[model samples]
Target: MNDAQALLPEAIWRDRIFNGDWIPALGGSHTFTEPATGEQLGRVGLANADDVTRAAGEARAAQAAWAATDYKERAGVFRRAALLLSKHHNELSTWIVRETGAIRPKADLELREAGAHLLEAAAMLTQPKGQLLASASNQLSIARRVPHGVVGVISPFNFPLILSIRSIAPALATGNAVVHKPDLQTPVSGGVLIARVFEAAGLPKGVLHVLPGGADAGQAMCTDPHIAMIAFTGSTAVGRSIGELAGRHLKKMSLELGGKNSLIVLDDADPDIAAANVAWGAYLHQGQICMASGRILLQRGIADAVIERVVAKARNLPVGDPAGGAVALGPLINARQVQRVHGIVEDSVAAGATLLTGGSYERQFYQPTVLTGVLPGMRCFEEELFGPVASITVFDTDDEAIALASATSGCLALGVITPTLARGMRIADHVPAGHVHINDQTVLAEAHAPFGGGGTSGNGGRHGGAADWDEFTQWQWMTIKTEAPRYPF
Candidate 1:
């Protein structure tokens, strides 16, 4: 088959699920569109409670066989899926760019990173971490990772492919059956794409199922008795709702939620590096990322020089067609996002904050905005903007900067800019965020470290280690005495 045909065959969804191979949802469908451009792409089922039940039933039935499968065999499937992803990289990239409006390089990066993650997952599954023995009598039992019976995954729009696959790989690697409810806005990239990869890897039909729809679908899956865990990535509002439901049901959950992250710059920091880094963090993906550095704290002595450098850096970011390769910034996901961003900027400007550079939105595009003299009352300073808007504030002391950064309730990630290691260590020690980078932009990792938030960010858990893959699983300990007891005689 040709590459296009191989990637998404005609009636593929129907063939896979609607047919006898799997159970189909009875709910209605909605048309999917590209966020950057209002182009119609495809349709996804807005599943109902019955749909969720059916999926859960199938997953419960499938879990035993999946759990019994050897880890190496499971790892082999992921390896093959990674190879397939790389083979069809462009096709996947095109779909991601069209559906999510990620620039070509960024889209490609996500795709490649996803493939790499899968490869890493394969290795991790093959050699999961074991428990260290603490004492002879106690046996310091550390059960290796074993999958939950049924895991329900709810992914976000901003990072459909990467996030969805990130959860799926480990869940399946540890032998859990999964019911994935992808974001309605980008179902093709998140839900449909992942299903195909699992199918290509010859994963059992009911091991991984995708219900591409809205909140009701998610609510149904979250409340379902068959679901043992719920892995969610989205806004703090919705995340709290999920957390509540999960808590009510007492299901294991990993919540990667919201953030109003800050970028702190010290007096000795490099103005050029600091400015460029903040601009990139604020503008990349139109600042839709939870980890986006929305608040910028600068030492009073260097605020002017840093602001000038930031303005210079902001001038170079081109906003246009993401696939065109020239643009650095793309359109916000939709009209709601545009209004949300505009409202924050307007509120900040109205609250006596000074506008430094860009703060205007043209159509779906919002300008790379910079604001100074920010106060805690302004929306940008108080809430997570999730847009290409940066608020720069002057602080007289490290204590003042740390206090300001901690003022907001949200604490997923933060960036620290300092000239000396001593000062960076101090800031790092004091910062409340789960992830802190010294003298760099706020960015997430695809491998080799933990990536999630604190407080509102997520439950404390590492993602890149074998221990993480084990977290998706459960443990069983068995022991035997080699020597017979004298009482037996």
Candidate 2:
């Protein structure tokens, strides 16, 4: 058995709503299966409205105490949590690999990344980043970031550890109590890992609650009045529904939704670099990512050359067991995702598109696929595929490339590849996306840079980095009138 298998008890961690006490799921118990090997791993309780209420109540009651704790004290707890995560990263990584079908190296990176997030949050306490603006003669204006009270985080399974808890670290660091509902598919890996960190850090049990359930449970959490904010990362369709719900409640929300992201290759672009990075961006995780470069816009002059390079690279990518070091890729999360990707590929071929490489399927594993002669109206280009398929389009000029890149209604991320720095910067300016990368893929995420999309791609607000913490917080402005001014209104 791997370290993760050893650390996690063979007996599944049963779920009961945590409301200062454990109780049975409102519905009943359900079993969870590992996607990589279609074997039953464990069971989790399915929560209903009642459980959401109890969990919200528990979080609400603990909010004040957690908020009252000094920022430095809270940061110290985060530091301890970071230490604990680092110590047991290998175990957590192995769990992530088995549950989510993530390759060992990528899973290991996520483990360390989780610890890094906590450490970064701990460091932010020393520098609150709140500011004091210009003051009038009689008054001094100070702006402070206040917690949102309690936050509901609904995470997806694609990236169990990173996506699941990305919001939690910032929400907790900024004095907000978080109710985290990890995706049912990989709950054990994400939930167990974070729970250990919190326990080692000596956090109050109710400060952070992990509720494992399905969509109904997630809706309950969103609609709960006690939830002051909702931070969600998942499909665009689901994000739209949750966004509407949060809006009805008038709760603060941060959504990192779906992306029909694109990579633009200028006429002068280096085909080798563009092809290699774009292929990696699209096929990583079997192309199951929000910002996967689903669309490739190539300048007419070099379109054929770039296509040749991408086809060769795609042919070389190996798909096999995630546990094996030689494997460069793994299966999709489940049979449903596998079908979805394959269906899209079939539709593309039927629509008069040319398949350069891949397009074969074996169970959950999908060979990397590249398509050219794709039209804008196709589902692959119009909507987020959320799978490992790239639809290629050629453009006549830089203007045309930029237009094609931004043509999709969704614009979470965009990549620009150009030999000249000036042209790359120019193209990036026109593309409407939350995050833009030059000469690189859109998967790039930095701790300090704000992440999220603009337009139909996602909601208005962003997350991560210094700016993201402020997103979960409301500003409380205070003005002190020390002495009487000449003119007082």
Candidate 3:
């Protein structure tokens, strides 16, 4: 049996959670193998468009009661969910590590982040849902937040647990029913476990539905009139497609798309400190995160020093099956991802980028690669390589650095390394991004922070804190009077 199978009960990874009950998939079951071992871990039901319509209908029916539930009571459900996630961390973490090929630490990070979001959502429920408004003529007038009724959330494989929860928990907390489609690759951690947690937390029946599906289900979610909003986290290509569909359907969209982020090293920065930050940003989670640093820009004065230290770090890093033993890096999600990553490296080399180290892979375990002399147009510098490769391009002036960072709209998150706070902040502001960091790496986010990017990164919609109210709820104006006014005409 695979580690995932050994860790989970046969029933834990069901195909779908429909109207609060686990059911066999309507479309069929899809086999899921552990990427680390290539062993068949288990299977889950693949939901189809029919299932999406049924699930959305059920959610629509349940939304009214859920929305009317006391805010405190709604908060209580998620509060319990947070504790339940903590209580079952061991089992959930194993599913994440084995299924997603995430290192143990990264798996733990997913659990921690997911739990925090649940807690944040609990607090969000009790926040003021409406506010009194001053009107020109009315005696009493108010503007209030109301649930969107039904929200469709589509999550990706990378960082499945947290990415799924960041949208799901808030949508549920704010009194919207949810129909979720988890990426096929990591259904257990992304969908099944979340359903289990919410079920155990006493979430009402038909309030949430978890569907492990593909394009058909996602398409249904986007076009389903009953689903008022669609929250998606995935590649730029897919996000754009979904955004188009949502627009045509006149549905609200929260899209967190991919990024070819950058980490810039200034002349005055310490090479050791800067290199360590770059390595972490580029190689963490095998660089499968949207915020992972895809390009490294070093000023001429510190280029050699930083590149040398980065290359040394990359060469020394361990790569293997995360499930088998302790390794700094784990396999890619599958052979396809491995091929894509290697292809990018080869293409970049042909484009004149010097491969400093690591341009090979054994099975899915890709080596931590370091590339220097990478120009702006090369594949390594231009594309969002979701792999353990650090591609570097040296810059001469701040003007050139800003131009390089601004050349692409892939700056979902950006980092500038400089001890001079004023200089770093100024440079960061010049580059357009959802989030910016000075003296730090690119990949980092809190559960409660308003998260998303501008332009291709997303459409102004955000995913946490007050952004949740904006994303998952609509506004309405109300008026009340002690007596009915006579006709003024």
Instruction: Flag the better candidate by lDDT, 2 or 3.
Output: 3
Q: What TM value does model 2 have?
A: 0.93
lDDT per residue (tens digit) for residues 1-489 in model 1: 574567765366642332114345578777777766687877666677778888899899998998888877888989999998988888888888888888888788888888887887787765735565454673344545456799998999998988888888878877788898888888778888888887887887788888876777888888899999999999988988999988899898888888888889899887788888888888888898888998899899889998998887777678887876688888898999899888888888999999888888788988888899998888888888988887888899999989998897768787888879898889888878878888787866665466776677776654655545645876766444556456955
Between the candidate structures 1 and 3, which one is better when assessed by TM-score?
Answer: 3
RMSD of each: 2.7, 2.7, 2.1
TM per candidate comes to 0.93, 0.93, 0.97
lDDT of 1 at 142: 54
Candidate 2's residue-wise lDDT over 333-443, tens digit each? 888887888788788789888888888878887888898998888767777777778789888988888888878777888888886989989988998888898989877
Model 1, residue pairs in steric clash: 146-473, 146-474
Q: Which candidate leads in lDDT?
A: 3
lDDT of 3: 0.89
Question: What residue runs in model 1 are displaced by over 4 Å at the alpha carbon?
Answer: 1-5, 14-24, 132-144, 482-489
Task: Give one digit per residue, the lDDT tens place, for model 3 in 365-472.
Answer: 999999888997899888899999999999999889989988887678899999999889889879988889899999989987888887778886777788888888
